[model samples]
Target: MADMSLGPGLGSSDTCRSAARQAGAPRVLLVIPCFNEEASIGGLLNEIAAIGRGYHTLVVDDGSSDATCTVASCRSPVARLAQNLGIGGAVQTGIKYAARQDFDFCIQIDGDGQHDPRAIEKLLDAYRSHPTNITIGSRFIDHSGFCSTPMRRAGIRLIVLALNGLFTGGRITDPTSGMRLLDRSAIAFFARSYPADFPEPISLAWAMRAGLTVSEVPVEMRARKAGVSSIDGIKSASYMIRVLGYILLARLVRAP
Candidate 1:
């Protein structure tokens, strides 16, 4: 695990506004957490850069035994972990870095190329329009994107139902979506503590329990461009059962 020492604070509003003026906008960090995604990460980074958003990109290489680090480093700064931590750990690492660097917002994008970079604008627009701590890019809202398999969609629906019942703050249609944008407050909260098991749904529940507001917007997602998913076949069934149990447990526990 990376040592997470808090960096200098955000300082006064005047200073923050000055810095934003210098940078042309508030700093947004694109955190890509990957494991053995060398085949598609480079292209994904290129696509993000081509959008001319001027967002900083950080690739968290989750102890991949392959050349994922090298390939990612060619396009963006790579934070190579010493060992394989699950998706949750990798994402927490990126969030910690974002906190330490005093980024105004952090957006999590899967390295498998399943998330579309073009949808980033939609997420940003939602953030600007609403007072939300987290904005999730959902594929099920519009049903226009490349939704996951039938089995996975069914599992996600079950999880969403559970979350809606347990968390009355807001309705979540895509609890399993990895594509999400977190503001500074949300980033700091997640950096301090995050769910290690079933992070997607569990973290959403935990955030709501912590009194954070959540919202979702329609975004188009693509199928994976390369490499196989970590969960597939029989593993998908196990994933659903385990994630549902975790979400329930998360609801029972008080958020720290």
Candidate 2:
């Protein structure tokens, strides 16, 4: 999508010539943020590699207390966070890396395997077709039979409704969905000021506030292959309130 070769050739410089020659690859980085997701990280990395896009996958361990780092290290090009930073921190670290490396784009997928590597093409397609927009994967857009528990679905709906209100005209079906693709401009914005917690919705609001193009494409999501959700039960309710509050705060802070 969008000239898969969106940035400089893999090795316009001699340093990366070998990497470039090994694969006539595009300069894309798949940033998977992990929190104790050892069981699924291996499978996710292998699947992403199979996409055959010369796109490198980097796992930010997020201070996972389990075998996450070991599993990730077994794979090349993975970055580990020495301490457990929350999701936002881990993702911000990835964005900074992507920006510094001059990557054309960065795709954020879950380390839990709920996000499908196959959808990488769709994200790339969306980004290519709408070069200026940030493409978010929306599970509810056409709901190709993927199942979400009723309670979880309800919470997602509530968040989307609130997000639309705050943003005035934006319609987002999955405000908390972790799967997203960001072009260079979007990446630069996130690298500098990503929200510390409950970032997806807040980031969307921030993007719209800055008059950036933001869009969503429908993608099927799989159930988590392993590990409990980082936000659920009491934590889910707490996070919902926290995320909603952040959305309001973002709107207020941006208002004239």
Candidate 2 lDDT for residue 32: 88
User: What TM-score, computed on C-alpha atoms, does each candidate reach?
Assistant: 0.92, 0.87
Q: What would the per-residue lDDT of candidate 1 be over residues 1-256, giving only the tens digit for each residue? A: 6532221232335676578869768788899999999899999999999999888888888888898888888778877878888899999998988898788889999999989898998899999989599999999999996999998888888888889988777789998899999998899899999987789898998999888989999998998999888777788889999988877877887865
Off by over 4 Å in 1: 2-18, 21-24
lDDT of 1: 0.86
Model 1 residue 240 lDDT score: 90
lDDT of 2 by residue, 66-139 (tens): 98877877774556666776888888887887887777789999999999889988988887776655888889
Worst 10 residues of 2 by lDDT: 1-10
Clashes of 1: 0
Measured on C-alpha atoms, candidate 2 has an lDDT of: 0.78
TM-score of 2: 0.87
TM-score of 1: 0.92
